[model samples]
Target chain A: MPREDVMATETQLYTPSTAAARRTSGLRLSRRRVIHTSLTYALLLFGSVLLMVPFFWMLSTSLKTLAEVQTWPIVWIPSNAVWENYPAVFQKTPFARYIMNSLVIAIGGIIGTLIGSSLAGFGFARLRFPGRNVLFFLNLTTLMLPAWVVIVPHFMMFSAVGWLDTYLPFIVPAFFGNAFYIFLFRQWFMGVPGELEDAARIDGCSTFRIFAQIFMPLAKPVIATVAIFAFFYYWNDLLYPLVYLQSQMKFPVSLGLRMFQTANAGVVDMPKMMAASMMALLPCVVIFFFAQRLFVQGVVMTGVEK
Target chain B: MALRIRMPKTKMARREAMEGYLFILPWILGFLIFRLGPMLYSLFLSFTDYAARGAPQFIGLENYTYMFTKDPRFLDSLRSTLAFVVGYLPLNLALGLAIALLMNQRVRGITGFRAIYYLPAVTSGVAVAILWQFVFHKQWGILNAILSVFGAQPIGWLVDPKWVMVAFVIMSIWGVGGSMIIYLAGLQSIPTELYESASIDGANGVRKFWHITLPMLTPTIFFVLITGLIAAFQIFESAYIMTGGGPNYATYFFGLNIYFTAFQSLRFAYASTLAWMLFAIIAALTIFVFTTSRRWVFYAGAREDA
Candidate 1:
């Protein structure tokens, strides 16, 4: 699911040539270069506008009165940007508890994945234990196994351990290293110059220390990429939280947003739900844009680059 | 620092024996205690008839036998699941690649357009479900509004059993931004020299794309295609929230069926069997992909096309 976003960062740059072609296609203007540049800017402005519509629509709906939201001939702009909905969102439906729960799950997931994947990745790339290739391939095998294949066992397992209604079920497996993250980290680690680790070996640095102090530090980019991925996934998690969490207080934003719809039932509150949904997704979008550089690095060339 | 007495005739430091275990200990423990242990327990329980409350009753092969004969819903859901996977895989790849191609043309403001396309990908599934529900509503929805302009009737997006899968497909299209990113990245990785040479050889855009870009991107596409197919098979959340597997069980997807049987109907034994079957299928499919990928995936600088 995540591997594709890494594709976008580099491929998206080629869009400029469309503008170049479009300008040249339409006109017999002598100053083709200037027209192409202006046309490119115009397309860019258009693209920006198109992109902003959904966010703006979400915000406006969130602010509009309930009546205003359901009205036909949709309101393109809100009379006022309602600051109150944010507060209302928090006030309604244990939103604060859900937010806290999301934060804990997201953080715990990141920490666990970072520790688990880094060690496993380092082992695969640098260490030579028995059945190393087999173990690494076994780890990679998990990549294609859909979560549904194990959801029943996963649910029962957590329930039996009395981990249901707690964050443990959500956070624990992440610590064991996700197959994708381990693969990414190992791919990144494989490129870390052997000379460096060898020098550290001669300096009496432990394998673990070299992994900790040297490889760990050097693998920050991939680590950041994995962290960003874990954050988005945890943030987007619906099935896990839906199954594991029985209590309303334990619900994360993902499940919490669903409640807004289910709570409303047939008489769907399109405005409030849309607004709340938009708010719920803000962190994911923000984090993605912020950590995009790492994502690009992962997609383009990580292991093979060095 | 160089007081190494031949480093005990090994490159590995002595500290590795201790810290190595320490580093992996958390993950190993997590896997054993949280995932692996429970998974084994569930497998054992599947062989027995153990409801959450009742004591275990040994019933080996009963659940599996019942699944093949008595479980009609499982069959239905399996059909839906398979249909969905077939539809979704091609649609996602095509749409994602199309957007990537459009954005790949060196257009100005491509960044903003890329971000817009990517926005829905990052949006919560809950929000997306909500938005899609409204958009696909039989009447008074934006999609219907657009359709009316083209002289088409309103669609029963969330209702009508026949059209239910289409609803999921529409929703899926709204989220192609992430895959678009990956295609974009793959595009960027291809050296410009290849395209330039192709252009000099009288290759037009489409021909160049077919000859160079698509071939260069075969690896990422294959990667996305396999993973995407697996994901498509596990379609639970959207069907759960939007349709609730209703409209006369039109969208009763396999994952949703498992959830209902296990959680709602308290049929863990049956659910586990269903899950196990899915696991086997996924395992087989993954193996198939791994075997075939070598034939088509063209890794950079690799000789003989793989």
Candidate 2:
């Protein structure tokens, strides 16, 4: 039977006369609900449009001629769309190379973060250890420590080791588990039933085997969340790249876009700049749309669920 | 062989501890090398005259003293950062909650709206900052064009000292969709029974929101506030990319100051001092929020009186 039908029948059984009266009032209630819903939609639509103007403006500006971009009454749409601006972005700078550098850093970071964080998280969640609680607390506290606190020394260390102008500074730190991602993994791992581990143990599966074969497979969601977070972090990162990388060839998309802007200096070409910005943003937007559920879940996991 | 002589329970405990350590070994190494070592080295550097060249001279407390007494840029950076936090946080929280409420409504196409809202939050920061530069152009910008429809004159958003921070705050609202998702998650977690029972007690929507929803969401609000405040204090990319700390240094944020001091000027010691100062401010503010959170943050299952 349909669940709604069963619920309706149960409701009718409890109070037949009241149910009939409720039907009449339900019509009025639904009318109010409709009105409320319409008001909500109107407000939401208004806000969404208001919020989306920048993006729309970006797209519009990207396709406009230089003169049209500076026209008095802003042209909503260019009469002749300058689709060439998209290709022009590449002609002007090593944007393709920048995207590749960003990808290398982001992917390398994700791999390291997944390996490091998952191992630590599994250990914390499932193993018995001396000072485990204290250690975990210490790890958590590091999440609040500002990056600036250690950035100077990190730069000095990297420069001393001649890792400057390379992706090493960006990618190498991920091998050390990030406190936030570890926390996420640990939280997810903690929720798995103890019986699964016990069953595996009874079959003589080693702890590492149980973690690798059993827990890791079951942690696809958290893994996805961590990977997405890592991607976002590395992809959007500007400061680290800005501080470490000096060569234009070593620049990530973030620094590359900045270089494009400053390269022109006073004579700003608005359309081409918009086009480059759009290109730089494309991968992130695409990834987000595809993996949005993971993004939302990751954010919620960071909240005070415990 | 030694473990085999011990009690089985103790032996198992020892094995688990060993396994735990093995699993977390990577993290432990990372913590020591990347985090703890750098932090101590940074602290040491802050008290020296290490200017990225031949710097071994220890200048005890001189950097801190100069920062406090003589550096006008330090004060300016602090003023701008505080101004940004003030202008940005409340609006971000309120708008995030408002949009979350709208999204929580049982309306069709709400997911589409949610995605549209979140789209900006996930885009590359450098790209978005560059895009906003065009939007905030004095005369040719879409914002000005729209304002002119109401007969308001064009304002120099990035160029004007008074409006640069306002421009930044306006740009920031585009990313409020991030917090909106978190708020939506918090809203979903609230038990429907609370609202049902409140309806039985003749509570209106506003009363229910005030008496139940707001209190229930305090923990989420607290989380958002802390994270948002930390992020706000780290503002650098937008100011650097869009305005270059601008016309008359209006947008010279602390993060930018730290960057310029360390990288551009090669004043590593002074920059380290600046960074420590930032860390102190962030830590103090975070500690303050955590202390105050006990009064306002509501945990659902925890003892109410406690």
Candidate 3:
């Protein structure tokens, strides 16, 4: 599909035809290419440095002493690395418990999203159903519905049910299938060849069995994309937790970090706060580095499809 | 092509329909319980007067009337949000596209550069805000330190009401990588032959970009602008964490206003009214975008209502 061409710009730009043209043009092309490549490198390098400064500052501040962090000249790097700030993050607050809370929520969210989105996506993509188009359209409309629209009543509903200060509000919704992820999975599922499903159907497989035994097993890539998105969503989510979970014990990392910052309002411990920020930011950065392609693919597919 | 068969729904088809519903049951249940239920409750709540403790009393648009006529904070938040959207959206779109254009060049280690630029996109909003808070500190901030290098006096980023929104705008621009990748995909999708052909027809680089690239990228640009505007209007986390909707409420975005109204003041009914206003605004804007999109957003294939 044209999508493959779009996604793999790396390979497309370095195609053999272009290499052949460069080779045929020889020295002039080589010199021009050298200048062109250098100019590209210079521009990108400057941009990369500018972009990396905040991250670099975060890491630098995380290891600096409080005095050094607040010093006038702005310590680009500390004269001494206070590795104890990382330990101090746990020592001063319930950082470990916050991480645990975030992990439980993120993991729960991922599991629920995968199961719910995959099942619904499979049904929508592969099954013939009355009212399917209407139902799908309704689901798609929810994508444009901002979260704050229902948040007030959602809070009151949860409060009525006495589910406040628990992870229920954050994790439970993920089990119902997100509109965006369902759409993503539906798109992926639609591209799967009909031959496999046909063969499974010929074997007298039940519809659910066809999905489970045939489709779900082959849906690793889309599942990963959904899981990654859900993980980040849950881990970084602050509003729902802030509104629902009032206690420090129930606070996820995002809320925990916010609370920590607020608690130090007047004093402003830059090193410790930054250390906590790095810990909160680490998992997402690591995940993005590992699954950069999937991240890019998800963004591109959503934009194009919409 | 010569023979066409149309089959009416039979017993098998009805059974398939039932199975489809069964598969999608979780989502349906989830939607009812979580999405549709809360939405209806919110609509009802908007017409009532309730603080957390008592049964909501029917107030008949009193909350909405108060918001429109009496509240200063409400108007301030609306103005601030509008200003933020105006400032952030264009910079995000332009910077995202410019960076993407540079990244599109055939350079070695381009992925590394992309990764660096995208790092902020993955970081939690709370964490990013905390980091930027340090960077925007009145004294000893790296930004001020850099200004010192150029013999320019330090300007308060978060301290001054005039600059706090600008600081938030800068932070939003830092995450432009998200849109940049989408633009990159759009650029990649445009066949290189279009450029080759244009060049052959005596089009220079500037003319080619104006005639070919921008027009071809209209759909993507439209997507970015719509989503960016929606996201900008809903600005919450950074304002909540960094500014706390202050330096005299300069960064008090609409989302933060709803949040504070509901959670902090416990005015569920008023918050509901505010939430509905946001919903209506978003819905109207989305409809506007869709209506206006036909004028400029070019599609190479079958078009769908955005």
TM-scores, all candidates, are 0.85, 0.94, 0.92
Q: Is candidate 1 or candidate 3 better by DockQ?
A: 3
Question: Sort by lDDT, best first: what order?
Answer: 2, 3, 1
RMSD of each: 8.3, 3.8, 6.4
lDDT of 3 by residue, A53-154 (tens): 888888998999878876777888899999999999998999999999999989988898888999899888988886787889888888777898888778
Model number with the top lDDT: 2
The TM-score leader among the candidates is: 2
Q: Mind giving the per-residue lDDT tens digits that candidate 1 earns over A1-306?
A: 244344443444767565555545535444775776576566555645644555665666677776666655555566776667777776667877777889999999999899888887777777654445665665655555556556766776677789889998877777788777777888888888899988998998877789889998998888888898788888877888887888787789889988877888753566667767777777777877877667656655522232
Q: Rate the local accuracy (lDDT) of all candidates.
A: 0.73, 0.88, 0.85
- lDDT string for model 2 (B127-201, tens) is 998888888888788888889999999999999988899999999888999899999999999999999999989
Sort the candidates on TM-score, descending order. 2, 3, 1
**Stretches of model 1 off by over 4 angstroms after superposition:** A1-57, A78-83, A301-306, B1-41
Q: Residue A217 error for model 1, in Å?
A: 2.0
**Least accurate 10 contiguous residues by lDDT in model 3 chain B:** B1-10
